[model samples]
Target: MANDEAAIKSYLAKYKHRDFTTREVMSLIQVYRSLTYRLEVFVFNNGTRKNLLNLEGTIPVTYKGAVYNIPVCIWLMDTHPQNVPLCFVKPTADMTIRVSKYVDSNGKVYLPYLHEWNPNGSNLMKLVQSMIAAFGELPPVYSKPRNEMPMPYPPTFPTTFPHPQYPSQPGPTFMPHVRPTAEMPTYPNFGLPYPHPGTANGSQFPTPANPLPYPTFNYGSSPEVAGGTITEEHIKVSLLSAVEDKLRRRLNEQSQQSQAELETLRRTAQELQEGKMRLEDILARLQKERSDLDKNITILQEKEKELQSAVERLGEQEGVDVDEAVVTTAPLYTQLMNSFAEEATLEDAIYYMGEALRKEVIDLDTFLKQVRTLARRQFTLRALMQKCRQKAQLAC
Candidate 1:
């Protein structure tokens, strides 16, 4: 018995490393006799108490060096095969076993363990039957292979080594289960089936239920939510005031900017006006100078024509005297006697005599002085006209 207990303890230690819970370990021993031959089980914390309650009347026994605690009633079944030894013991809350059979390649009937254990060519059926005989029934809970079944629950790990009694925050100690309130009053359910006792006309004033106070929302002066203790009209007035203030400030700024621009434009326009007037004055002065120059040119041309005509007349008079001097070289007194004798004889002889006498007596010095004075007048007039033209060009 000591050796069997040691072996069971050793196997249980191995199972502890595998992270199988006590319930899962017991289930395996119940379902598979192969595991029961060398099964080990242990309990810690609440698990030990739960196991004791499940196998209340069972006795602990030993097989092949391993100890098992199982119920005795399963051993009395006549249908169980004889060659297999009752080996396994299981402790659990519920006792009901499920089994399936399969034939091995050697044509032997075998019992499968859970959904995972391979019964083919392994004496699993005989082992499972022995476990059933010892345990009375398999544990109700079982584990299946990962590929073939869904997990019963999500995996978890120990959150604390030494668990704390109190949670981090205070939660509700007792929450009363509350029934929902009845709906609002309706017409048909308002005691309409009962006859009114007071009034003969069947009209009676119903007692009024107390009216609930209307909720008051105070949104303060924040512009976000529109509802408040303040009326909507007051809010609208405040909003309009704010908008008007903003608009007034913007308009003032715009007006100031516009006034500044207008002043600048006025100054610019004044400067342009002054410039235009100056240009007009200059244009008028140039035009007047041009007119004066044109008039002076016309007068100078007329004076030059007159001077040329006078010079031509003087040249003709001078040529008459020079021709007379070459034809009649005699004294003035002898030319007078030739004239009087020619008058008695011929008219042509008298005319030639008078012309010759007049030419021989004319003064050359006086004629030259008159020509020099006319040429000087022409030069002075031309110079005055040229000066006027240059002044006009400079103004332009």
Candidate 2:
């Protein structure tokens, strides 16, 4: 560690006399100080003002014979002799080194005071020298150049034309173009003039004449006369003509009513035809169902009879009496009897048959209603028919 410190001191001494511009010195000081504290320096060129310096990771090498872990920035003044301000140590990897011209509250730029490094206090001289070695030279101060010469003035002009394009052209002419007439205007009067033709002025013209003359009843006058009297025969003829017109109107009205009634009757006939077709279909379906029921009843009766005979045979084989077995199977026999009971009186049987028929009709009506609903929903006829057959068998 002693050897490394001595080597850092020798390197810093070599850069102490180096010619460095103010900006370069400030950048090098930041890097040098950061390295002395064992903190890495990352130089970033912001492309404008002061170049930024970022402290990242750690600096393992010693600088100016001292070790530190804190990071800092060194800002340079813009004018005359360059100086720096002591900034707080940052714990982050990157920090901005702001270069600003110190200004008073009146907005005037002021030169910053130079700081002297104490060897016993902080040994900042060695770090500043090392910073000068790393960064080259400081930038020169800027100022505006002075201006000379006065501005030129524009020329003046008179308000009259100097020369004309067409010297012989005529001047503009002005005159009134319209002339008045001597005829007087006329206004219409509201009332008609008496003892005069059509106008209030005394002019010889036709007056306001009545459109129709009173009718006369003189048949003796000429038949081709322009204005003639009416006779009793003409009155009779006119009355007959009016009566004929009324009769024709009544006949036309009756004809229209009759045509409407005919149309209603046609619609009623169509509905009745459809109802008849539906009834025929229902009757056919009922007949088919009755046949199937009869077949099923016969099959069930045969099975029942076979079961009774088998029970009797089993009882006999077990040494039971035949009369006792018959008595025990009497209920089964009665059920079969009830199933085949066709000897009821015609009136009673007819009544029961009518009730059964009514029930079958009601079932058919319900089925038709279901079918219509399915049809309205666009279900296939074949599918509906299959479902209906399955449901009817299950009901049975």
The Cα local distance difference test for each model comes to 0.35, 0.34
lDDT of 2 by residue, 1-396 (tens): 455444334433323322333233444435533332211221212222322222221221222322222222332222212223222211121111111222111111122121243223433344443333222121111111113111221143211111111111122111111114421111111122111223332223233253111111222332522333435664564456446544544674577678879989999999999999999999999999999999999999999999999999878875767545544235544443333232233234445545765778546566556545544433343344445445445332
Cα lDDT tens digits, model 1, 150-212, are 212114422111111111112111111222543111111111221121223222322124311
Index of the highest-TM-score prediction: 2
Residue 61 in candidate 2, Cα distance off native in Å? 99
Tell me the spans in candidate 1 whose CA falls farther than 4 Å from its real position: 1-245, 310-396
How many backbone collisions does model 1 have?
Answer: 2
Candidate 2 yields a Cα-based lDDT of 0.34
Name the 10 consecutive residues with the lowest summed lDDT in model 1.
159-168
Model 2 RMSD in angstroms: 53.5
Most accurate candidate by lDDT: 1
